[model samples]
Target: MYSLTNNQLYSMPKAVRIFASSALSLGLTASLIFYPSASQAGKNDTGVPAELQGEWRYGRISSIQYQDSYTGQSAAPNGSSDQFQLASNGNYKRNRLLQINTYNCASNLFIEEKGKVKIEAQRLTFQPSDSTSKGQICNSGRTYSSRNTAKPETYQWSIETNEYGQQVLVLETADGKGKAHYGRPQ
Candidate 1:
């Protein structure tokens, strides 16, 4: 516990001081990074709409696109350019990026999945057209393959304008385990 006053802490042994300071520093950093600020807590928005099709980008990386979340909300800001090529031919290819924010560093991990997609009424079904690999890509410690494309992952999706006025495609995974939001980078 940091019960010692600043004066007392300064008088403590060097080893004790270093350990305590390191622990405190790490805890504070973690809290600050994860604590949602007022503007980030949540904003008023029209929920996912019933129609979402065509192409969308995460930000500006023409090669990078779509992101996934358990809430189906926009994971990135309104300026991301994640690309999604949704075609009427029931074929699609999109990049999924997972941001690892830690170690005083930020890294983007992505995997591209391609397959056949069908949007009927309110249901969106996907049948992977490529079974070779999901294409594992990591911009970090090591390259790892993503198991996201082992089989078809379907979702019920809709389009909506967020509070920031960006058109977003929101979806919930088939297993009810994750929700994701997609939008055109402004």
Candidate 2:
């Protein structure tokens, strides 16, 4: 058994120290060169998750209209334009459904029309509550009404990336169906 003295135990040869330092420095350089950090991976050019579960600010409302060929009547096609303000804090709200802090609306009228909304991967679905038809009149001179008549409609939404890497959500739905164009507030 060869026992080293106290001084020798704590001391390393000059050559060994130099070799270790060089190896460490080389490893660090290699890591930085080959494996860039997440922040350095092109300016964090990412987009909102497929699931729109966070808060979104209200943007615009574009009414979609169409002609009912059968009745030759101009009908207010089922469609709506809305915005969303998403927060990293995991809180989310839809402009067409509820008025959030970032939304500017006199009343929650849109909510009454669209009802509750939920976003799934690349799709948004909502249903208008029966209460929305409170004073709505039908063509028969009777009050328009519904008992859970509002059914859930789904829309396929996508995120578009431009040259600047900014993102925009493109929403499309069937004609005479739910609203169109849902995106972040301008």
Candidate 3:
């Protein structure tokens, strides 16, 4: 077996480097690393694994706390929820909603997308057939809507056990800047 130094490993392409680092850290072989059946679930004919087929939802709330002149300390809250339906044959639909409330004003956005998906080397790629987006601000009475066809989007995907001891699907953007955790509806 050959060994790679940090310098050599860091010189690889981003995806390769990520794969290599994960494989090395987990002591997994290349073949075992990307095979869903080895760790999570079995794959179907289209390479969309069984674990990924079904309804999954993600929700998160974020708050910013700051000192206020009159209130001493206050928090501004925002949150988002996303739902995905993945079919056995590599078809998918997604609905996402986001809301922000602060200073007696509220803003909301809703997005829907449908597409075909494929899994390769732990990466999930979505080829969107259609998409729609709408947004509104309550206080300003401003609203907007748009419909567009999106290009293919890809993300690294994995299955993990969440704090509740349930299997969750995790997807991260290629740059690792955006991540979402999806779980089966309770």
Candidate 4:
């Protein structure tokens, strides 16, 4: 009833050592081939990557050159929150809320879009079947549901893992003007 210690195993013959190392390597390679990580779980029914088939909330934005303001109040206090819901069936819904605060007034805008999304190469094209937008400018109030006649919006996209190990979806404008970062709603 003898047990081989690590020292005894290391002092074994060269042939035995090589064989043991090869066996260990083969086991690791086989495990990797059989068990994939969550991200590598394969595509959804709509062909969306497994990592991108979920709800993501707006996190931040950065322009290619400078910080561009959507409300013209670049230095003023502003807040925005958006959500992108991607279904495995190729359907998606986006809800966005933007508020702008100026020295004299504040404006708010909200937009909701529902559509089918397609991913090709590194681009994601959203063809909205329906859309609704409502906003208020200072004091004036307006509510409207208009058909989106604009062409399908497409963006270069990728999922990046931050230092904190959180998945962030980076969507760059088709024109390469800016990138919007989104993450899971905490």
* Ranking, lDDT, top scorer first: 3, 4, 1, 2
lDDT, candidate 2, 55-165, per-residue tens: 333243224345565666654433223444443332333333311111111111232233455444455454434323221122323332223333455566554543444
Clashing pairs in 4: none
- Model 3, residue 54: distance off in Å is 0.4
Q: What TM-score against the true fold does each predicted structure earn?
A: 0.47, 0.33, 0.68, 0.64
Top candidate when judged by lDDT against the true structure: 3
Give a tens-digit lDDT track for model 4, residues 1-186: 001134433654443334333322211000111122235346876778777788988732222122335655344355566687989898999876655544544455566789999987678887778776555554444332334522367788777766676767777766554556677888
User: Candidate 2: where is the Cα deviation over 4 Å?
Assistant: 1-51, 56-124, 127-131, 134-147, 162-166, 174-179
Model 3's TM-score against the true structure: 0.68
Task: Give candidate 4 regions above 4 Å deviation.
Answer: 1-41, 60-77, 142-151
> Residue 131 of candidate 1: its Cα lDDT?
35
For candidate 2, the clash count comes to 15
Cα deviation of 125, candidate 4, in Å: 1.0
Please give, for residues 102-182, the per-residue lDDT of candidate 3 as tens digits: 555566667688989978968988777898866666447767566753356778888876555577777776766566667
Give the clash count for each candidate.
17, 15, 0, 0
Q: What lDDT score is found at residue 172 in candidate 3?
A: 73
Candidate 4 whole-model C-alpha lDDT, 0 to 1: 0.58
Better of 2 and 4 by TM-score: 4
As a whole number from 0 to 100, the lDDT of residue 95 in candidate 4 is 78
